[model samples]
Target: MSRYETRLEDYRRRERPSYRVFEGMQELVCSVGQLHNNWLYVNVDQWDQDPVHTPIYYLDEHWLEECAEDGTAATNEQDEYIPLWISDRQVQTWFELATFESVVEVLKAAGKPVTLQMVIVAVKYYDKRDAYLDYDEVKAVTDLWFVLTKVRNHLTE
Candidate 1:
């Protein structure tokens, strides 16, 4: 019915989040970066937009619980902003963006002032399980499962 309802449904249906092959169901959080390229990767709520400076009063801790209780009614309590975890793959994307110099170009296109500091965020999902594990039985969830690289040039500094 509403966006929250849709997300809740999606979560309920998805027991596993990432789209990869894993040995088993292991809930983990690791700080990772790409060696080939420097990018900061993080896990976040896929639906939330880029982080804002101010404290997002819109979302509270109980917000997620509310969604769990009632998705359609909890639409207003949604606050999927804060990132849950970070990964290394995201750094690779930043490295690519930097190599192409597209990062600066993108900011300019969006009218966002180019700065030495930047935060890139992406939302993705994964489905990984062992051969013995049934795809339907193993389910996990992840948000912003991509790398977000930030780079600042000399001019910005």
Candidate 2:
């Protein structure tokens, strides 16, 4: 099986191992809830009350090596990469994009019109959900909004 499949199986069995977050400062103890858009939906026990999606890159070799050296890493022979933690910055970006995508999907499913206001609300919700917003997250939301706005305008026209 591929590394991704092995991780998925681990998640299904609720076997979450600890991994290091950004700069190896914090550890994330979580299980995989789902996968979407090539990202992992994880249920972090340390911070979030709910599951959150993060980029798969958090499990890349470099981060894993740092975690291993610190004795905070968790993996097995069947695993190629194990994601143990997510940085504050990564969480923000992931939350923003994932929430926005979810909102869009819900609107589509309900056959409701996707408006600028809806997208704006999604971004605002994420901004307020966290204690503080990172500058990179702010930029990411703004950039996504710009692109969405263009798409919306084009579709309407």
The global Cα lDDT (0 to 1) of model 1 is 0.25
Clashes of each: 17, 1
Residues 49-75 of candidate 1: C-alpha lDDT, one tens digit per residue: 332321111112343355446542222
lDDT of 1 at 102: 34
Give TM per candidate.
0.18, 0.24
Question: Candidate 2, after superposition: displacement of residue 16 in Å?
Answer: 24
Which structure among the candidates has the greatest TM-score?
Answer: 2
Q: What's the CA RMSD of model 2 in angstroms?
A: 14.0
The candidate 1 region of ten consecutive residues with least summed lDDT is 25-34
User: Which residues of candidate 2, in runs, are more than 4 Å off?
Assistant: 1-97, 130-157
